[model samples]
Target chain A: MASTGAVTFWRSAGMTYNAYSNICAAIVRNCLKEPYKSEAVTRETVHFTTTNWENGIQGKPVTHEIFK
Target chain B: MAMAAMRREGRRLMVISPTVSLNSTNAVRSPLVSQELSLQGTRSISTQIVRTRMKSVKNIQKITKAMKMVAASKLRGVQVRTEQSRGLWQPFSALLGDIPSMDVKRNIVITVSSDKGLCGGINTTSVKVSKAINRMNSGPEKETKYVILGEKGKVQLMRDSKKDIEVTISEIQKNPLNYTQVSCLADDILKNIEFDALKIVFNKFQSVVQFLPTVATILSPECVDAASETGGKLEGLNSYEIEGGDSKKEILQNLTEFQFSCVMFNAVLENSCSELGARVSAMDSSSRNAGDMLDRLTLAYNRTRQASITTELSEIISGAAALTG
Candidate 1:
C-alpha cells in the first residue's frame, strides 16, 4: 500500500508504462494491417534473474543475459 | 546479437551521414548564410532551445505525475478484485500443488500481461520465463504451447516462440477487467486445446516498488485424479458425492471450466495490480528525472544570459573609454 504522501507525489509524475506496453504488444496484430510500418520499440522492460555463475549480475538486480 | 546490433548501428550511421554531408555542402556554397552565424546569435539560439526543452520537460513531469495519481487511484480497487478472485481459485491450486511431477504429455503456458509498457519490465519478465519454459519443453514433438494474453506478451513471444503460440488475445485490459471475459477465454481454451498441464505466468504485485514474475500451474484432470486417488488434499473433493453416474464427465467439465476461469481471473487481477504498482513507481522516477533536467536547463539558461550581458557590458565600457580618449 502506498502512503498518502507517495500518492500525492505520483499525481505529479510522467506517462503510464501501460500505454507504451500496449502499443508494443500489438505489433503482431498490427502486422495483419495494411502497409506494415515495423513498429517495434525494442527496449527490454526488465532483465532476467541470473542463471550464470561468473561475471553475472546477481542478488539485488538479478539480471542474466540468457539467449543473447 | 552484439555483432548484428553493431551492423544495424553502422547502417543507421550510413543513413544519417548523408544529411550531415548535405549540410556541409550548403554551408560551403552559401557565404551570406555563413556570415549570419555570429557567437551572440548562436548563444541566444542555444538559450531558446534550452528554454523550449525545459518547457517540454515540465509538461512531461505534469503528465507523469497525473499518470501516477491515476494508477494510485486504480490500485485499491484492483487489489480488492485480486483478493476476491484469488479466493475463488486458491483451493484448487493448493490441491494441484500436492501432486508430484510426471512426464507431461501436453502443456500450455499462459502468460497474462497488460497492454501497457511504462510499468518497467513487468511484461518482459513473464515473457522471458515463458520462453525459458518453452526451451525446456523443446524436444521431439514439442508438447508446450503458449496462450498469451495482452499485446506485451504476444509481441515479445512472437520473436522466439512464434511457432509455439496456440492463442493470442489482444485489447484485453481496455476496460475494467471482469470474470466473464476471462471465463469466456477459459472456455475457449478448454474446448480447443489439449493439455495435461496448465502453467500461468503473471506479474505478482509484492509492493509499490517491487513486482515478481511468477508461474503458477493449474493441474490437468489426470494429475487431479492421480492425487485424489492417493488421498492427497482430496478429502474435500471426495465428500461431494456425484448426483448421477453419467454426469461425472459433465461435472468434471463444468468444474474444470469454473476452476480454469477462477485461476485466470486471479492471474489477470494480479498482473493488473503489478502493472499499476510498476506504473506508479516508473512515473514517479520519470517526474524526478524531469525535475532534475529542468534544474540543469534553468542553470544553463541563467549562465548563458549572464555571459551575454557581461559581453554587452564589456563592449559598452570599451566604446566609452575609446570615445573619452
Candidate 2:
C-alpha cells in the first residue's frame, strides 16, 4: 500500500518486478570474475530436443540450445 | 521295458537343455511328461527361478551403482551452486531482517520438493513439516494455503490436504536451475497468490549425509509495515540511510520482490543439492542390498544344482550294479 509513488523506474517501463530483478541478476551473473563467470554462464545454458509427430508417422528430431 | 524306460530318461535329459532351462515354464509344463520325472522337474524349476532372480538382482545392482555415480557428480555441481546462491539471499535477510514469528491472517507455505523420487525421505520430511505447520497455524481467523513446487510434494499433499493447495508448479527440475528461471517462477507465484506472510519449506543441505527440513519466512511489505508500526522492531532499516527520500516505499517494494526471488532461488538450489546427496546415499544402500541378495540367490541356486546332480549320479551307479547282478 505504501508503494504507490515509490515504484522503481523499471516498473514504469511496463516490466514486472520479477522481470526487473531477473535482469539485475543476469547483469550480476555476467559481471562475475573468470571461472565463476564461465560456470554461471554454463549453468544457464539449456539444450533440449523435440520431434514433430504428424498423424501416426515419425519425424526427425530437432535439438535446440539456449545460451543466456 | 527296461530299454524303453532308459530311452525315455535319455530323451528327457536332452529336452532339459540350457535353452529349455531358460524358460522355467518348460519345467512347469513337465507334469504332462510323466509322474516319475515330476520330482526332477520341480527341482530344476526351483533352481531356474533362483538363477533368474539372481540375474534380475544383478541388473538392479548395476542400475543402482550407475545412479549413485550420477548423483555424486550432480551433487558436486549443485553443492557448489548452492554455496554461491546463499550469497544472493543472505544480504536481503541482513537488510530486511527476520521477524522470527509473525501472526498474520493469511499465510502461504511454499513447499519445495523434487520432480523425481527415489532420492530419499527429503520430500517426505518437507511434507511432514509443512503439515505440522498447517496444523499448528490453522484457526478460525487464520488461513493457510500451500504453493507446491515440484510434483512429488503435490502428489503427497493432494491425498489429505488437496483443498489447501493453491498452486502446483512442475517441470522445474527438468532443466538446469538458474536465477532467471527461478525469478520468473517467483514472479508468477506472486501474481497468483496473495498472502501476508510466506513460509518456504525446504531441505537445507548440511553435508553429504545430512539434510534438515528448514522453514524460512518472508514477510510481505504490508506485514513489514504493520510490524514496524506496532513494535518499531525494524531497527535494522534505521541503520541504512536512503538517498532518495520519496522513493523509500518503492525501494522497499522492489527489495521485497527481489528478496522473495533470492530466497526462492536459494531454497531451490539447497533442496536440489539435498536431493542429489540423498540420492547418492539411497542408491548406495540399494546397490549394497542388491549385492547381498545376489549372494544369497547364488548360494541357493548352487545348492539346488548340486543336489540334483548327486541324485542323478547315484541313480546311474545303482542301475549299473543292478544290471550286473
Candidate 3:
C-alpha cells in the first residue's frame, strides 16, 4: 500500500513538471519577439530627447543669433 | 543473507536522502507480483495530467508573441518622431525666451500618458506627478484643470481625484506624434480661458529600463528665458539682436507659436519612448518569472515520480514473498 501511494505521487508530479516546461517554452518563443522588442526601443528614444531638452533649458544663456 | 544485506543498504540510503533512495529502491525491489500492476495504473493518470498542462502553456505563448509584435511596430514610429524632435528643442527654448511674461489668473496642466497598459509604470509615474501638482494647487476649494492625453491616465485621474479634468484625448497613436492634435489642445488652452501658466508632465526615457518622470513649465516665459541664457552661456557665445525686416510683435508672435508647438512635440515623443521602455522591462520580468515557475514544477514532478516508483516496488516484493512462502 505504501509503495502504491508513492508511485501515484511520482506519476502525478512528472506530468505536472512536463506541462509546466511546455508553457515556459511557449512564452519564451512567442510573446517576447520582434515588434514588442522594437516598441521598447522606440519608447526609450523618445524619453532620451525629452529629458535632454529639459536639462538644456534649465538655465542657459540666450544668444539672439541662434534665433536668427 | 544476500537479500537481507541489500535491504539494509537500501534502508541506509533512504535514511541519508529519501528521494534518491526511493528511485533506486523502486527498480531494485520490483518483484513479479500482482501488486506491481497497481503502481502502473497511477503512473498513467499522472502522465495524462502533464499532457493537459503542456497544452495550456502553448496557448499562453501564442498570445504573448502577438502582443510583442504589435509593440515593436508601434515602437518604430515612436523612435522616428523622438529623433526628429531633438533639433526643435533649442529653437523652441530660444523662442520662449523672447516672449514677454504676463500675469494671468488660471493655469492648465497637460499630461501625456498611454491608453493601453502592459508597458509597466509609465502611466503610473505620470499620474503621480499630476496628482502632486493637483494637490499643490488645490487650496480650500480651488481646483486645477487637467488636459490629459491617453485613456489610462484620464481614467486613473478621474477615478482618484474626480475634479476639474478639463479634457481627455484617447485617439492618439503611439508614434510619429500628431502635432496637429497637440496644437489644437494648446489652442484650446490659450483661447478658452485665461491661464497664469501651462505645465506639461511626462516620462523622460533614459535607457532601456530607466524612465524618469519629469515636469516642465510649458508656457512660462521665465523658463524660456532661462533656457536661452543657458544655451548661450554654454556655447560661450555673445548675444545679438535680430537684424531683419521683421517687427518685434511679428517676431514675438511667430516665436511664441513655434515655442508652444515644439514643446508639445517634445512632450509627446518623450512620453511614447518611456511607455515603450516600461513595457519591455515588464515583459522581460514576466518571462523570467515563468522560467522560475517551470523549474519548481519540474523539481516537484521528479520527486513525486521517485516516490511513486518506490511504493510500487515495495508492494510487488511483499506480494511475491507471500506467494512463495
Best by lDDT: 2
| Runs with alpha carbons beyond 4 Å of true place in candidate 2 | A1-3, A24-68, B1-46, B323-325
Q: Pick the candidate with the highest DockQ.
A: 2
Task: Please list the C-alpha lDDT of all candidates, in the order they appear.
Answer: 0.67, 0.79, 0.58
Candidate 2 residue-wise lDDT, B1-325, digit = tens: 9999999999878876643564555664344334435565564445666777899999999999999999999999899999999898888887787664788889888899998999989999999999988887789999998888877987898788877877677767778887777777787777657888899999999998999899888988777766655656675574567786555566666778889989998999999999999999999999999999998888888888888888778767866775586
Can you give the lDDT of residue B291 in candidate 3?
59
DockQ of each: 0.01, 0.19, 0.01
- Against the native chain B, each candidate's TM-score is 0.80, 0.85, 0.70
Residue A8 lDDT (model 3): 34
Error of 3 at B303 (Å): 3.2
lDDT of 3 by residue, B126-207 (tens): 9998888766766654546777777688768777555566656554553345544445445444444445466678898677
Q: How well does each candidate superpose onto the true structure, as a TM-score?
A: 0.68, 0.79, 0.60
lDDT of 1 by residue, B87-154 (tens): 77777665445232444668888888777789889888999888887777657865888887877887
Q: Which 10-residue window of candidate 3 chain B scores lowest in summed lDDT?
A: B96-105
Badly placed stretches (over 4 Å) of model 3 are A1-68, B1-58, B69-77, B97-104, B139-143, B174-176, B188-194, B220-250
DockQ of 1: 0.01
